[model samples]
Target: MKGLIVRIAAAVVLGAAIVTGSPGVGMAADATALIRAAFDNWRANSSESTVTMTIHRPGWERHLTMKGWTQGHDKALARFTAPAKDAGNATLKLGKTTLIFNPKLNQVIKLPASMLAQSWMGSDFSYNDLSKAEDILTEYSHKIIGTGHAGGHTVYSIEALPKPGAPVVWGKQQVKVRDDGVLLQETFFDQDMRVVRQMTTDKVGRIGGRDYPVVVTMRPAAKKGQWTRLDTTAARFNVPIPAYVFTRSNLQNPRN
Candidate 1:
């Protein structure tokens, strides 16, 4: 659970930054401020929501459904209810230790010090990107390269390069931002500019009184039939999430 939450946070934070950060290329100085404002608005209230994930590939597919709650940015709970093998599994991703509940074993396992670069649920998103927010500005310096179009929308093309001695993933990244500073798509590259993976957002809407993209998708750039889509439904903001909602035991004994 800890690992999953970290990946979820990383994805959400970066996506939110991209969505709220774009303003005008001519007003580069204001981009940072605009992004901050957007973030604050989105985070104005804590949230709880259910996520239904669909994974598609050439010969295989999966449906992962979970209902969980969250408070602010650091805590989350998810209960898996699909793909029989993972059913009745509950995970609480809080801070560092990811507590996983296995009904088959009737015990909770703590996953710590695990490899951070592996895939989550056999999908494209890495384990590292699932938890903590990647400090792009802190770990890598970015410069506006140019403007481009992604998903048929005009976007600002920004190139990011890692700082010296920073152990970052990918050699570089290209971000496509809308005129208002929302990130429409992000492309990760190797040293030679060959795209490694890509993340995109669709179906933007106001959820829980904040602007949110209802659907997020990630996939390898050259993969023809591999992709993961996360669809969020009926999200509400600033709701009182019970303290026990994030506990490991609750996931194992959800009916309690």
Candidate 2:
């Protein structure tokens, strides 16, 4: 009887452990699914957008208008269209490589790894930030840390940590995603766990039958009263884009 009671107790403990463990696993899977869905919503098969970027400094502000094209997350091209001085300047990203075309010099300069952290077009966003969409889902492990209400929507707070041996610069990233697949905010941290910068959606509305952030802002934590704002004026997603548009030649002499 003593032996039989001991065996029954062991079975009950095992059953409890299984019941508790299953929910944790399920939650993790659900979190990953949500994250992937959010990323997919923003970066469709192909997208074209016209945007205005405003760089605000303590002393002055500058605005630039640009047209951007993306073929999935691996390829993207952007060309400045306004502010005559900045017109004809273009940037292209293909996989891990990025190039910039200066219309004045009529030359294409490849961006080295050392220059990835430099500001792009004098904006708060870095070249690495521009190319992050291509590798974020693959290079980091994500976990849903908590949930809360923000901007009258249910938000999922997620933490992303770099995977072992991943060539990522951020030590961790905290993201706030809405239930409807809108990314509300993302905060980036350095290796020492210091806040580096943050990107937030200042406005969200319907665009092309999909909900998206129409106005987004990026600000560096170390800077005071300085921020870069991107306002999307027009956007079309899942449209076919020509292959040549992503080439280096197109970066210099854009067809459209």
Which model scores highest in lDDT?
2
TM-score of each model, paired residue for residue: 0.73, 0.86
- Relative to the true structure, candidate 2 has a C-alpha RMSD (angstroms) of 14.7
Report model 1's TM-score to 2 decimal places: 0.73
lDDT string, candidate 1, 90-175, tens digits: 65656555666778999997765454455655656554444323345446676667765655555666667878888766688666
Error of 2 at 35 (Å): 2.6
Evaluated at residue 206, the lDDT of candidate 2 is: 80
For each candidate, the alpha-carbon lDDT, in order, equals: 0.55, 0.65
Model 2, 1-256: lDDT tens digits are 0000000000000000001112233244355655555554455566677777788999999988877776655666777889999999887778878788999999999999778556778877766555344345688888889898876767888888889999878898887767766667778799999999877778887875677666777779999999877776776778899889999878988888
Local distance difference test, candidate 2: 0.65
